[model samples]
Target chain A: SKSNEPPPAPPVVHYYMNNLTNTRTPIENSETVLILTPLAKFYQEYWDNLLKISYPHDLVSLGFIIPKTKEGNAAYSELQAQVTKTQSGPKTKRFASITILRQDTESPLQSQSEAERHKMENQKVRRAAMAKARNSLLFTTMGPTTSWVLWLDADIIEFPPTMIQDLAAYDVPIIAPNCFQRFYNEEEKKNDIRGYDFNNWIDSPTARDMASKMGKDDILLEGYAEMATYRSLMSKMYDPQADPGTKVKLDGVGGAALLVKAEVHRDGAMFPPFAFYHLIETEGFAKMANRLNWESFGLPNYLVYHYNE
Target chain B: SKSNEPPPAPPVVHYYMNNLTNTRTPIENSETVLILTPLAKFYQEYWDNLLKISYPHDLVSLGFIIPKTKEGNAAYSELQAQVTKTQSGPKTKRFASITILRQDTESPLQSQSEAERHKMENQKVRRAAMAKARNSLLFTTMGPTTSWVLWLDADIIEFPPTMIQDLAAYDVPIIAPNCFQRFYNEEEKKNDIRGYDFNNWIDSPTARDMASKMGKDDILLEGYAEMATYRSLMSKMYDPQADPGTKVKLDGVGGAALLVKAEVHRDGAMFPPFAFYHLIETEGFAKMANRLNWESFGLPNYLVYHYNE
Candidate 1:
């Protein structure tokens, strides 16, 4: 029961952290979104791209939680400097708020290196901690006036400037854009774009069968050759010629650039730290939303580039 | 002196005409825009396209003034019916307000036919009357909180759904996207897109020379064989490969879809009903803005389709 209690609303250390003018708009005219990010590390590109978003800054609230680790501490200091500068800026450029939160407990795994973090064995524990951090940020920063929640990964380097307005215009309950990255193609002698987010996918009979046989602690990880879920991955669906508004039904969702209606969250949809229907974290979030009758959607051609590293 | 008085605020006949829930957003959080359209006749396509704009409706206030004519009466009836239906609709779908005003005076030109209206001889009178109508709408409906003013022609049937947000993101004082139309090319035996608004152009030495020789009332009209301005038309600058944010300096602008910062209008930039710098109406407004040190910008590749008719 004590573990179930959400880490005491990780103190709202900063409110209106991005707003210098301190201008407040009523709920009717402003359709607002709270951007939730879980940071294990900070990249300047991520912050730059966030500021490049064309959505009215004053209407966008931000929530971020850094892990209680050395890298996260460094990220916290860097993020704090940017927030201070942006918070004192002009009226229209300022965001409604920036909520900085620290994870209640230390991350399960000690190493922050990519090779160790990306190991198939580490995913279950890594994501469970990530889900907790997300839950902490969501429960603490989401406010009464928030209309939408955008779960953005700190490593996402580029997205359409109008991504927020473009996604919100669809008026869907929950949606994610196709995440992509630029990688060097040795044979082609040039850089090429490829899908980066494997979490977005449609369920398959094989995955269902595999899930039924798994134990309570076992999780279904995507993009792993060993697991062989045989699911239809949303990442592979990107077509440049296809209309960006094209939508496909999805059973699993990637956390990168996910946009969701606030009502979906208020109605009790959240990231499950443990396995749910053989899925964990964001994928498990889709399961929870599905249980609540809210469908998960993916825009195959609406691409947001993630940092390749 | 009495004629200069603004037609007594045109009786705000309809306020919040589109907002059913009557929601209100604060000035700080909501960057507001007023969409002003002067209508002599209305097509269902116009109203439908207006509704299709993806801008947050609650932050968009609309102003429409139908001319005093037989066609105007029919448009008013049709527009009123649609407004009544939309005003009572769901909350987020409805606009903040739809202020519909009837022109204080009858239009100078009576013929609504394409052939009669497009005659080169009617250019001066036609544009002068249009200038008056625009002034009336702008002066009456623009409130203290309004941040931008979009001069949209009713017949502009298609545009990127996020046009408002896209245009506002530029943060320029005054800007207009290239207006184009689809036309059948007899030689090519296919429909092709062609520049439609010749009013958007760069000033030239030839145009200045031509203007100096003309009498005070002799207005310079673009797209005429006899009076060549030899200007670099913005409409001709459209290139599919260019970035959408590309902006070019201009001494003139078109009214099809002009976006202006509210401060420009508040600072006394207006449509000149009479010849001002050898231009009238929208182009004259650009001249006034230029005189006040606000540069005019045209997005050649950012095209919005005008009604072919």
Candidate 2:
């Protein structure tokens, strides 16, 4: 039988950053940080931050560009200029040099009719962009210097400097910081404010009796509390006697602000190839953890306000 | 490893005729036969036939009288008289003594109140009848008699007189004859002569395909041709890629006709308590045969028409 015991922690922290438009201010000790961006604007923003933070660390910023068509070559001339700008700078002697990487693009189908051709070309562009980000993350982590890889979404803004340290405190194989909906209150608070009079939705007397049996502590959070109340009032709900809880253990947690250990990636853990974007990574991570018998937990006490709007 | 080989055949055929009524019947000379009955009308009709058939067998007619309620003592006394009459008969002198049995009136509920109560009552009656017959058959076959036990439905009328000999020819542990619906090709011939397309009545195209695949040769009679076609079509519909040439084994044949070796009964091969009616009995028999890894097949060539109308 495989051991369910947790693995030991790694020594260093490695952050894997993906950029869409432009980067924010960078951290100190740049050698410890690896910034991966696609747009030229993002590279310029990082260059500004490099001057500002002035910390002694290695920095590798890979600027990815997809060629327009199969006939067109992926020109590194534009990326080479950005690389020259960073290396030839006054603080160049501090840490490792910044490298600009461009992903090669295959041509979209040219034979199809104009409408069909446009749609296919658009699809090819999106796939190439995704492939670039996934491959870059994989390649950087494959090196010996990397320990843990932190995935930061392209649009995140207000994250604390000690965010990495907070994640490290868990010492668990996989840790995810609580990414709260910035404007929304917790579920319990929302339920309290609603103050609905009627208890249960279903009118079964037996259900009403069961609902009376529930203690206040069992109410959980707001939306969940209402759901539990409704179920308690509905006698026709699934019998508690039938739920023998010895299966896969999971309460509930979302996959944003996730921090994964190096060993998980070394064991060939990968995101599932799904067409949909949001839940694909989350589900893949959960399934991988289950397969490897790794424990995963979310720290609700440590919340991150994601400023997407 | 358990033996997958079929059992060798017995030398003699054993027949158990269950008289499903209360009238006393004189039986003589037969090695062993159990006649089970509950009502009186059916008992009188088969008395003479029972006497003639029992000539080469040791026969025992078992009767059961059910009380109206737990408080009714008069009903119990009446049951005793009915059982005593058959046991004292002169014709039964050369055969095993007749026995009577009754279900406990005050037994606790063993089935669900809604659907299982009716089913449980029917099973109780049938099991009591079968158990008494099994005990008598075992007793007669033990002493100076080489016999096999055949279980026959009490309402069976169209059985051929040479049914025993036909069953005896099989060099297997059990023999089951092919059963057909009483009504034959009359409706089909009338429809065909009238130039009516009866095929339209079959709603599912798959069912029609199945009927055609089984073919006329595989079907014993014209009436059952549709059913054979349906079975063939249904199998294909479930798994289209499955091999068409492979023969699919059925769970159970209908219980209109059944024959078993006496030793099987003697060695405690009694019918399970669940099968009260023909459908249930057939299902139970099939399940038991499957558990023992015994081969059970319908004799396709010889068909018995069970007349219900």
Candidate 3:
């Protein structure tokens, strides 16, 4: 009879999606998916597609719309009107599953220069909103559960309804799916996409060699593909199999989409706010998993399409 | 036309000490002193006396002794009789002014064990009589003809004689003194002397150390005391002052007495015979002067007393 017998377990599944303002169909299980997004008219089509998806999991969606100061209270009224209109849908079980969250108008961006300071501030705002939605969903759900938390970018479309089932087959703490480019055109295909991909993956040897020659203020986008290849090579050198039970060193995983164990978030393994936008968020999560000796896998088989516009 | 230019000068100094036998004293005009002793009789006594004195300048004395095996021959008889019957009195001019040379009966004890080896052998039975005598004196006299050399031993009296003044006064090739020793009872004053007179000098701590510890199986008695001290100290450390113009490192010095030029015995130095009695002679000579950049000196201040039993 210990006094602290751990807080009662939360829901087994939680989903967080960003910017769900202009969608039509409501998510069937509103308690499963947790969404965090900036409120904007351009996200309408993307939000509608998410609503139509047959996601049989809990969902928590949030919208961040900073009202313009010049527009005064008009902007606030418009945001509330749009949110309410989206909620007023067909009286189906799926429609009842959706939840709408709006940002307070007082939280508007003060200055453009301030917003341009660094990518970190923008990521902080997004990560804070997502965390709030995740906690709210967990608090409302009941029972002891080994929940799964799935994060999806706002503009993507979900494929087969069994996608979640396929992901659950692996009993790992974290899993990353291989993503394909959504807009694969003939011209793009003729341009040797693999070569382009290789270029993206392989760092320019010259650039890397001459890095010492660069000015201090020069901005560099280090090639992620090269980093991945190096990590893979180094892992093989340590152990060819890259076994989950064996210790593996990894730089990071990509952040476009990731599925994590719900307990990891509840246990304070939440994504760091500082890295919310930049690639560092993925790296930080990987580092945390390494510290805990938790397993993370990259599912080269499972494919997802990323729309890069 | 000039294929032969004095045959490139002999690397070793070779003197004919046997020729000086008729002339008991050194030639009046001679710049170098050549003393010869027969190894069979008084090798130990000869060197022991050279240690006590400090000579004036850079004077070297080379000691030569006929090998003990020569005592078995007919020639040994003539030499032995001549030395014993000879008296220290005024005679011919050549004998009157010449330096002293002492020779003893060849010893058979040389072939025996250490305890009996110190005594003189029967001169009438010496083996290889003439050859042994020639080589012994040859090796000793060779020291003078070069830039410098000295040969003396056998019942020598007081040292630091005018020989040092004569040698140092000139920039000539070689020089050595007629050494002497004093013998007096403990109760007698310094000037009072008993009837006995000994040729050998008192042994220095360094000479004792070298003869006992450093020489081991070698013919230690054939080494000079002062030279042995300098040699032992030089072996321990490089002294810029004592070894001013030399670069040779010596293991030890011959106790029988020595002084030599740098370039005298230049044919790869002397050979170590490895025999117990003859070992130190060549080894000591080579170490002190034959090696590259070597110069030698002997000090002659005190004297040794030769006791007659």
Using TM-score as the measure, the top candidate is 1
Error of 3 at B88 (Å): 99
Model 3 misplacement above 4 A? A1-42, A57-146, A184-251, A274-279, B1-309
Q: Write the per-residue lDDT of candidate 2 for residues B127-207, one digit (tens) a residue.
A: 333333332223322211224445554334444555655655553555665443343357575421111101111124544
Q: Is the docking of candidate 3 incorrect, acceptable, medium or high quality?
A: incorrect
Quality class of the docking in candidate 1, CAPRI style? incorrect
lDDT of 3 by residue, A1-309 (tens): 111111221111111111111121223212233333332223344455545545542333332322224442344455445445554544231222222222222333343332342244344454333333332222222111223555554434433444444554565666655444445467756421111111112123444445445453222223343323232321112222444233222335544455565444432333322221122234444544443345566554354554444
Candidates' C-alpha lDDT: 0.75, 0.35, 0.34
Better of 1 and 2 by TM-score: 1
TM-scores vs. true structure, each candidate = 0.47, 0.28, 0.30
Candidate 2 lDDT over residue span A217-271, tens digit each: 1211112332332322111222335432112222222333555554454333434
Q: How does candidate 3 score on lDDT? A: 0.34
Winner by lDDT between candidate 3 and candidate 1: 1
The full ranking of all candidates by lDDT, starting with the best, is 1, 2, 3
Model 1 Cα lDDT, one tens digit per residue, A1-309: 111111212111111111211112223346677898988888898988888888888778887878778988898888878777776767666777666765546679989776787789999888877876776567545543466789999999888878877777666788899999999999999989999999999999999999889985689999889889999999999988878679999999999889987656643466767676778889988986775578999999998998876
Runs of candidate 1 with Cα error greater than 4 angstroms are A1-28, B1-309
Question: Against the correct fold, how does model 2 do in TM-score?
Answer: 0.28
- Candidate 2: lDDT over CA atoms? 0.35
